[model samples]
Target: MTELPPKPSRDELTERAARVRLLAFDVDGVLTDGGLYYGDGGEVMKRFDVKDGHGLVMARLAGLRTAILTARSSSIVEVRGRELGLAAVLQGRKNKAAGFRELLSQLEVSPEECAYMGDDVNDLGPLGMAGLSACPADAAAEVRQSVHYVARCRGGHGAARELVELCLRASGRWEATVQHMRDPDALQAVKL
Candidate 1:
């Protein structure tokens, strides 16, 4: 089959990214390091970057809905989603496109308002459908070429953090956000 037309301009992508109402990530690569370790207790150990978690919290505070959609079903992924108050946690989905459609319907958000982050072949289809698509630094060349933004950092490192950082900057809140993080204790007093 022939390829689609040339991708939208960076401005269009960034615009979509900035206006995103929903942000969904593929669990393994985008959230974790794409490596799974099995312990003797039959539990899984996945390494998640602290910076990424902070970015996620910031995004949520900014009123953006977040979610995790992955083909693998694991309690680890489930726990992480619950910890973050994700809008959705879809796992063991062989056809991600279907899951995405279901999510869009449930969230009542249009495709153009959704931003999807992923790193492998399984991610390409949903990535193409999203108005703004992104991939980690270690993603396959094909996935990188298909996405509008390719994070400068690798997965499970700071790739997800870079995505949210751009959104924060685009929204003109990066400086204040950094300061807030630095002085969270001082800021907390104002909340009461």
Candidate 2:
């Protein structure tokens, strides 16, 4: 077996994260632990972490755009994206790099200002192109090796939250964002 490439140093990772204005995620392995469940009626079920949802909100509050790019189509993912107020939710995309490019163009964001979180081979193209990249602790070795940061938490267990927090902190927005979240008036000002 070949040795995996080393992760970037903390300072380097932080520097890259600080430049991010957009964050894109792969829905399965990066957000839902890569699990798939089906009911008798052929409905698909996926579990998502509330912390991750809050993290997306925090990113948006801090003036960052969030997007979901997934190969599989799921109504659950659509509802989740809406609930979290993500900028884009693109599904049924077999070629993720193309989808990612389309998302960037649609949002008018450059690749150097985007962060991507993924956990599988399908995620490699976007991850490699992103300004800052991250993966879950349980990600594939290749995926893990390619990213700048690997979260201690697994997917569906706050991994996405970890990535978002890293970027927020690096860019010096976390403190003010948290303060705003705590302010009842500030929270009430935003209509859900």
Candidate 3:
């Protein structure tokens, strides 16, 4: 097996993260532990972490656009996207690089302004194009090797939250976001 490059230092990550205006993610393994639960009627279900959901909210509050690109189509994903007020929720996009390009066009942001997190080989395209790439701890070997950052937490267990926090802190938006959480009116007073 070939050795991967060393992970970026905190300062390097912070510099890259500071330029991010959008936060994009892959659904399976990155957000939902790559599990597919089937019901008796053949319905599919997935588990999402509440903390991750809140992290998306925080990202939004901090003025970052959020999106999800998944190869599989699921109504659950749509619901979650809507609940989080995501700017985009693209599903059934097997060619993720194309999808990511479309997303960037739709949002009018450059690749250098986006931070992408993914977990498998399928996610490599967008991960390569993103300014700052990340993966969950449970990600595939190739994916972990490809990304700039790897969270300590596994998928569906605050991995997304960890990334969100890193972006917010790196960009110097976390303090105000926390203040806003403490007092909703506090956000209005602080300049982002």
Candidate 4:
């Protein structure tokens, strides 16, 4: 794990989180452990966190749009996004900030209503532009410095889930989300 800077106050975190309508992520170091594994057949192999996927589901249930913006294109990510029902999954994007802007336009949202999580310098542009910026504990030094929140958990180890939980809690929907998960039928009855 990397050394983390001081975290913002809970009030501040919740304040920023409350304004978020869309939450986007960077795929590599944010969702995975940043390990690139290539098979003999040239197949790209990546490990995804089930917890992160669940978090995305919960985010959707809470009425927040979720997206994935990655520089590297991968079929695995595409499948994962589909499984989680993400609003967008943009791969092979050289300019993540530009991609995020396009996503905002498509969703009819503003930067002030977007939250982004990333783990490298490549993510700085989106982080700077987002209303709430977050990163995992093991994120790059510069990324840690730039983010508003640095999760205690490392990447690929429930870090994304942690961010999602923060958003739910800040929006005063965590408990209800938990309850909804317990009673799937009841969740269907209530409108998100």
Candidate 3 on 12-115: residue-level lDDT in tens?
98999999999999998888988999989999999998888889988998899999989999999999998888999999999999999999999999999999
Model 2 misses residue 9 by how many Å? 1.9
- Tens digits of per-residue lDDT, candidate 4, 1-192, equal 666546668898899998888889999888998998998999999988888888988999889899998999999999888888899999998998888888888888899889899999999999989889999999998999979999998888889999999989899989988988898685564332
Q: Is candidate 2 or candidate 3 better by TM-score?
A: 2
lDDT of 3 at 24: 95
Tens digits of per-residue lDDT for model 2 on 114-179? 999999988999988898888999999889888888899998888998989999999999999999
TM-score versus the correct structure, for each prediction: 0.88, 0.93, 0.93, 0.91
Task: Give the residue spans of candidate 4 off by over 4 A.
Answer: 1-8, 184-192
- Superposed by TM-score, candidate 4 places the C-alpha of residue 62 at a distance from the truth, in angstroms, of 1.3
Clashes of 3: 0
Off by over 4 Å in 3: 1-3, 184-192
Error of 3 at 16 (Å): 0.4
Error of 3 at 76 (Å): 0.7
Q: Which candidate number has the best TM-score?
A: 2
Candidate 3 global CA lDDT score: 0.90
Question: What are the lDDT figures for the candidates, one per model?
Answer: 0.81, 0.89, 0.90, 0.88
Query: Where is the poorest 10-residue window by lDDT in model 2?
Result: 183-192
**Which structure is stronger by lDDT: 2 or 3?**
3
Please report, as a residue range, the 10-residue window in candidate 4 with the lowest summed lDDT. 183-192
Give the higher-lDDT candidate: 1 or 3.
3
